[model samples]
Target: MKLHCEVEVVSRHLPTLGLRNRGKGARAVVSLCQPRPPARGEQAGPHSACLLVSTMKDKRGTRYEQLKENIEQFFTKFVDEGKATVRLKEPPVDICLSKANSGSLKGFLSAMRLAHRGCDINTSLSTLTPVKTSEFEKFKTKMVITCKKEYPLGKNFPYSLEHLQTSYCGLIRVDMRMLCLKNLVKLDLSHNHIKKLPATIGDLIQLQELDLSDNHLESFSVAFCQSTLQKSLRRLDLSKNKIKALPVQFCQLQELTDLKIDDNDLIQLPFKIGQLKNLRFLSAARNKLPVLPSEFKNLSLEYLDLFGNTFEQPKALPVIKLQVPLSLLELSARTILFNRIPYAFHIIPFHLCQDLDTAKTCVCGRFCLKSFIQGTATMNLHSVAHTVVLVDNMGGTEAPITSYFCSLVCYINSSDMFK
Candidate 1:
């Protein structure tokens, strides 16, 4: 078949028009027709180029406008979430509060009268007004209010009326017994003379971690034992408290890997402690524990800090296998405490063979040296006639003898031998 061809000029402004080798800011001849000479006197190539450029510009402009609109919508959704303005303070600073979506904003602020520095919302007016934080005794700012109706403004701490004083009108005393820190993740009342945690503390369903160390807490319970966050809890620092016993329900925290109960008054651990299958690190150091539970044998625990406890059963710790990959086993038995090794290759029972197969495999391996004991049995000489047994590979492939080969021996034992 005969073909026709024609060369046409394509402008730089319409770069998408399939023009080839068009120099910067100039036009080049792009073919419009194939395999035939242009019709006589029909050299209208440049005229056709101008029409294509106008059409390409319209298409490109519409695409650019659509992309710009999508970017603007993305920012609008994020801004509505209050993501740009809400800020949370770090440690040694006030905890940031998230806006409440419940009830009236005023009712929420009235409830959180302990937040001494943050803005208080007025639900009736739908406006947030700045709060007047009162300076209490000893130069410590009252940033958090707990136990409402119990700790009233300027009641426990004598604040002067001359300087900036906290609002006492909306401020109700925090009831320590009915303590509710709902929606509160991190609470820091450390170094304070506070006495107790509210019983309603179990309501904090979203709490993932807790730090109640260095307090005068004498006893606590498992009211939050069934909380969904129980399994999600990974870290717990209850050191320096006056706790006397470990709760059995605490074993339900299967995901807890780090637990610190140092400097407590715990006497013994509940058997349920063994149920913590994921426990990797535990510190009961400086406590009054006389003996660890036999249940500790089932734990896959790797690190245990029992530095100051009286290891009552140190000699009887055989029930617990030290099979954890990297364990730092501390054995503090009364005045006989060991911080370093006395000899190399101590051959402790914890270092014994882990399983039967591994022990048998090692015994049959090439590293065999000398056996201290040897034995052989003739077993009544097997009666009237003399019997001889021949053992060989029997022309079969010789890879290695293993547990898998024992199946043939098992099969023969199940079948009749002389029938």
Candidate 2:
């Protein structure tokens, strides 16, 4: 069998002669050829079962060496995912083959071992043809399509694809074929006509950046917010959509560093927006948001823009909802939050687990459930950002944000900030 990979040849006897050797690798096709039987009435030659390495740059053609006689040792070492190294012995020189895809390397190594033992390979000769290294690379890692005509009509995407882009393709919905690309890291579907997203898009657990900007989406899926995307999504763009609101569970994507939802119809952001500790750049410009969430003060940002929003004026009196005896559900949730206990659907009810996932945190370093005192206070946008954009054409940089208090004493102690 023939395998395409990067090949390096090291001379074992060159170093002892006090000479520097070639320190570079080249693209090569390695093949295992069976012994050709002598033709009728022709004298037998020294040809035997051999392994051939044809380097693309080598001026002297293919290097053919008898596998059983010349090779003193043959072994393989794994370097990392999708990479491996194979060492071969050729008396005075050692041939090192590396940077090969794991699948091809394994097959090549197995065939080499069997050929070295003088066994007959049952494979067809057509499968042993050398393939151009450039062609191999083009099929393996990434695929980009900017026009609708370039998209594949089949159900399967290349299984090795890590980055796929289909921008300006006029797609009305996410291609179901794309859901099978589990290795995908960055998916850019921007400038499409997609009106809705498949909840299964979150099945791509390795996805880091997803761009669905300039679409016709009217709502973001809560199922997506609760999917494995929470662990991998780092950057997202939903600009120029018709989304009216984002689910509270949307804050579960704590890994986000850059977010853009500009030119949407959002009424308000997720209530637990501050849970995203890694968020640094935020732009929600031209939305219909009336006020920011109570936890907006918890964000530490490098840049923030809330321009063109009509923010409400803060009221003087705090809205009180104190419970003399906290409900059992509230008490249980508080206990779980205070102790930092981990919960999942398997360990507790799914709804209860979701409640804990979006639990409110008070300014006093405590968590609160439904029983808490609520207040609205005006806050300077500059307090949470190093660079702040004016919230309106009147040069206003202040907006009202809600605040929650766990108890009457906590509200009384922090009431001066509201005034």
**Per-candidate TM-score against the hidden true structure:** 0.37, 0.75
Regions more than 4 Å wrong, model 1: 1-101, 105-181, 193-195, 226-229, 314-419
Give the lowest summed-lDDT range of ten residues in model 1. 60-69
Q: Which digits, one per residue and each the tens of the lDDT, describe model 1 over residues 249-268?
A: 66777778778898988887
* Residue-level error in angstroms, candidate 1, position 178: 10
lDDT of 2 by residue, 1-419 (tens): 66655667777777798987788767666666644545789643223556666665542335556665455665554522334444446546666665454566677666666566666545532122344545445335588999988888854566558899999999999998787666679999999999998989887877999999999999999888879988999999999999999988788888899999999999999988988999999999999998899888889999999998767787778778778899998999999999988889999998998788777777697989888888888889999999999998889888988888999888879954546
Deviation in angstroms for 18 in model 1?
29
| Alpha carbon deviation, residue 190, candidate 1 (Å) | 2.8
Candidate 1, residue 240: the lDDT equals 87
In model 1, the Cα lDDT at residue 285 comes to: 75
Clashes of 2: 1
Clashes of each: 18, 1
Best by lDDT: 2
